[model samples]
Structures are given as structure tokens and as C-alpha cells.
Target: MSSSKKARTHPQYELLYWPGKMPGRGEFIRLVFEAAGVSYRDVSNEEENGMKIILDMISPESTGDSDSNPPVFAPPALRIPGEGKDGKALLIYQTPSILSYLGDRLGLAGEDEAEKAWVLSHALTALDLNNEAHDTHHPIAVAEFYEDQKEESLKKAKNFREVRIPKFLGFFERVLKGNEKQGEGKYLVGSKLSFADTTVWHVLNGLQFAFPKELGSRKKEFPTLFETFYQSVQEQSRLKEYLASDRRFPFSQGIYRYYPELDRQ
Candidate 1:
């Protein structure tokens, strides 16, 4: 290849995610770039023997010179090729952190102090809700199956549906409803879109898919919640395209799982 082409071949950034919807993270950060028509490579998978390969790459020993900059968790990390003033060559992780960083990069973060705070608050809240959601199904242990702890699952699922799901969704509904009073916006936090909007959209999508009977039956009660989701998918062509694309991936054994026993009141 030519020298010019060789330079072009270098990726500007690398996104590390367990390819496919291990619920590695929402496609939001990835979708942000896609929406902007930028290119990225997902390094969640390698042509190798096992999960060990992926784990080893992130492990302290395998990282070679870069081990000290490792993140708190592996899924959904990003690498920007250039180093800045701090000598940090733009490697970052934690879904929210990455999203927030990208928001600043892409000019999507809300414009004002109040808006910024609201966007961050909204984004973090959505993540909190998502963790609770996963906990509902795996109340016993993540390593064990829902079927393995069917009895404990039943009890936990009962609490989730009766107490938790409604509680979290209800809080979001209140957040949306309070936007006008709080001077937030039509979106979750600011006058413009942010990671918060994306996160909320996914939570609504996951909850709707996960609990059709409980959350699904009561959709009419949360107009703004549905409105944000509806508008987001329709307007964000990249996200809409990703959702329809193979890269968006299918939901499975990672975070959000459909447990009929859990949702079936």
C-alpha cells in the first residue's frame, strides 16, 4: 500500500466492547459517532481461542506499557489515538464517562451550566435505573441462572415488579413530568439532546421489552417517556439505522433478559 493510504488505515479511535448485545453498553456512544458519519472499530472480539483472550488483553500483564491506564470495567472502553497535554493518549472506559466525554467532543452536551448539570444527572439516573433492572432478574447471583434459582427468582421478581420497576420508571416519569416546572426541557434534562436522552430511550426500550405486562400495560400513563423514545429513534438516523443494522445486535444473556416469570403478575 502507499504511504498516504497507510496513514489513512490507522483508526482515529478504537471502541472496546464485547461485540453484540452483551448489553456491553448502549449503542449511544457508538451511535453518536455513527450518527456523525465517523468511522470506528469495535475491539471487543479478536480472532482467538476464548474469553480468556479478551480478558488477558485487558489484564495488567498483557497490556504491556499501557497497563497503568486500565479502566474500572472492561466493556465499552474507548481509545483516541492521540495523546493530549496530560500524556494520556485518550483511553477511557465506564459507559457514562465515555458518553460524557464524547458528548463534549461532539458538541451534544447541553450548552449551559444548568443544562449540563441536568444532562449529567439525567444520564447517571438512567444508568442507576438500568443496574437496578439487571439486579431484579439476577437478585440471587449473576453466575447462576434464573432457572437455577427459580424459587428465589420468583420472590425477587415479585419485589421488582411490585416495588422496583414501578419505582424507577415512576421516578423517570416524574422527572419528565417535572421538566416544565424545573425548566428542564422536552427531553429528559436540557433544551437539547444529550447522553441522558439516549440512556432514557434505551431504558424505556429495555423495560418495555422486558416487562410487557407491567410497564407495557401502563404506557399511556407516561406520555413524555414514550414521546422521547419515539422521537429519538425517529430522528437519530444513525441510531435508527443501527437498530435496524446487524451492528445494533440482538438482546441476550448480558443485561436485559426477558423473564416471563418475573413480569407475569
Candidate 2:
């Protein structure tokens, strides 16, 4: 036999998302992959015809043509190589489902079934906060521009800043404190870092990016809860490199947009 060695082949993960400078909902999935040290192709704006690929997948033509495959409703979908029926590629969408799938695959879900359930529960709750944060600027309609709903957004944002933010942050704070009281460590679930902690970190980062003044003012209340969690996540070595890398997109017009008029503290 020849002395040459065959190259190892790793599974390819393709992420389909909107082409822009914003991180959007895709950031949640990216965090899991990065923390797990799994390599993935972020094809949103990084590749040629990337947007077209996403458009085609979700379009009526392709979605209707794939009788055996489930239709994807939107972007932020993940395509895994050779994991589908008959050794085809597998496609999964929706942030929560995608994150859960990746979390389980990458061993970030938890150490056991019960712990996984707790992680999923907290992740879904963090998603709720993300949705609410997105709605602050687009209160009336998502398709419409922020200027179109400026009047309504002002009132909605005030309530979000004054009411909803506190409610959700307080809930997380209570959960963290409860976990600590029970000797479950600083993590959201169990004593180890789970996907739930990463989700919470992203949510807190987005909130701070969108409403810096408002969230910063309340830092004293959730010192050990939200603040500490965010700090800890940033300190993760691999995650830190990913965050400082060019591959990590910064928060922009996606999910959490900062409009001066709506960011009243």
C-alpha cells in the first residue's frame, strides 16, 4: 500500500441567514457552535449568491417541490451535511429548535435528560426576551420601517424599558439566585455551562446594545445574575476568541436596534 494518508472529513454545517451587518437570530446558533469548537460555514453575506440560496430554499417553488422534506418558513436555517433521509443533507430552521439540536449534538444541552429540560426551558424564556426586544422598534409591523411606526414605538419602548425589561431580568435573577442557593453553582442549570447560559448572555448583550442607558442603570439589581453571567461568558477562552474575531458579526439593525428616540431612560 502507498504511504500517503487519507484526509479526515468533518461534517459541514451551513447557516442560511439574511445578508447584512447585523448578527440577528443567527447569533444564538453561532454561539453554540463557537463554544463547542465546531466549525461551520456562515454563508449569509460571506459567500457569493448567499442571499439567493436562502431565497430559493424558502421560496414557494423549492419548498413546494420538496414533498418529502419539510418547508422552511424563514432564514436562519441550518443545513447539515449527509444527515438527512438516504444520506442527504438535513435542513433545520427556527432558532429555538436549531439551538436545541446543536446544543444536544455538541454536549452543551446538559449532563442528563432532566438537566437538558431545564436548559431548554431557560433558553426558550431567553428567546421570549429577544422577541420583545425586537418588537420595541417595530411594535406595529416587522415589514415596516421604524420611522413608519415611530409614534407607536415610543410608547411601546417606554413600557419595555420600564416594565418588561425588569420583569424578565428579575425572573432570571431569581432563577440564578435559586440555583446558587441550592448549590447548583453559578450556571443557569446544574454546575456546568449549558446552552441556556449562552442564550442568556446573548440576550443580555442585545438588551445592553439596544438600551444601554436603561440596562446600565439597573446593573446594580442583577449584579450576580445577568451581569456576572455575561462577564463569565465573555471570559470563555474559545468564545472570547470568536467574539473578537472577524467572523463574529456585531449588533446592528437586526433584532435589537438602537433608535435614539426610543431609547429614552
On lDDT, the candidate that comes out on top is 2
lDDT of 1 by residue, 75-159 (tens): 5677776653365566777888887787776666678777777788888887887887777777778788777777877787777
Estimate, for each residue in 37-65, the C-alpha lDDT of model 2 and write its tens digit: 77777876767887788788898756432
Off by over 4 Å in 2: 1-10, 64-67, 181-185
Error of 2 at 264 (Å): 2.9
lDDT of 2: 0.82
TM-scores, one per candidate? 0.81, 0.92
* Candidate 1: residue 257 lDDT (0-100): 81
RMSD of each: 4.4, 4.2
- Cα miss at 237, model 1 (Å)? 2.8
> Where in model 1 is the C-alpha error above 4 Å?
1-11, 26-28, 45-53, 60-68, 84-88, 180-186
